[model samples]
Target: MSAELYDFQDKIAKIPEQEKKAFVLYDVLGYKYKEIAKIMDIKVNSVGVYIHRARTIFFEENDDSSCRSRRPMMSMVWRLVA
Candidate 1:
């Protein structure tokens, strides 16, 4: 499980609007790409790309933190991108 920090909400609120919405829909809401796509009325490929971009930005911003402080769940995205 990930650390539940009160500051995480503030961190998320700081993210750009579109990416923040996508990140919350997919990660926090546990929505699948297809489900997100349908709910957002976007293409599935767009959903995937949005999530990929969001993950990249999130990881880059979190790099100064320790490994445990970064998103452990992001390893799945790295594997997919790799």
Candidate 2:
């Protein structure tokens, strides 16, 4: 996916520069921990922390109550699943 498709754009923008770069490299670019470490000149564990924090922030921001209020688009699916 491209940068335009990122769900975490607003939250990610709020992250510190170092952590933001690490998150984009690992999460968006799909780089392995070791590769991200090499590219960013950081340790593998730091990469892990950045990715984790980024995900947490993204979900916390996006998962507001209104977003979770799913009105069933297809009543049949909700009836079957419910």
Candidate 3:
């Protein structure tokens, strides 16, 4: 993996357990929202909400105006690992 990917993974490893699991199931494992909800024992809507919140937190933590141009690529990786 690239350094950016490593950094993103490290950052995601620091988030809450539920958020990490929800994110990984949905993104990395390519599970549908309904499937993730069933697997996680949560409402389907809650799955979407958790992912949104997790994505927000990840972006906020990595925000840096000096690296604005890299945000898009980082955001893509964040989706995979968050």
lDDT of each: 0.63, 0.61, 0.71
Rank by TM-score, highest first: 3, 2, 1
Cα-based TM-score, every candidate: 0.58, 0.59, 0.66
> Considering lDDT, which of the candidate structures 2 and 3 is the better prediction for this target?
3
Report the C-alpha lDDT of model 3 over 1-82, residue by residue, as the tens digit.
6777787777687768888788767655668899999999999999988876666666676566453233454466666566
Candidate 3 accuracy as lDDT = 0.71
**Which regions of candidate 1 deviate over 4 angstroms?**
1-6, 63-82
Question: Of the pair 1 and 3, which is ahead by lDDT?
Answer: 3
Which portions of model 2 miss their true places by more than 4 Å? Answer: 1-8, 63-82
Q: Candidate 1 lDDT, tens digit per residue, 1-82? A: 3333434544566677666667768865568888988888888888767766666666565664353222555554444345
Which numbered prediction scores highest in lDDT against the true structure? 3
TM-score of 3: 0.66
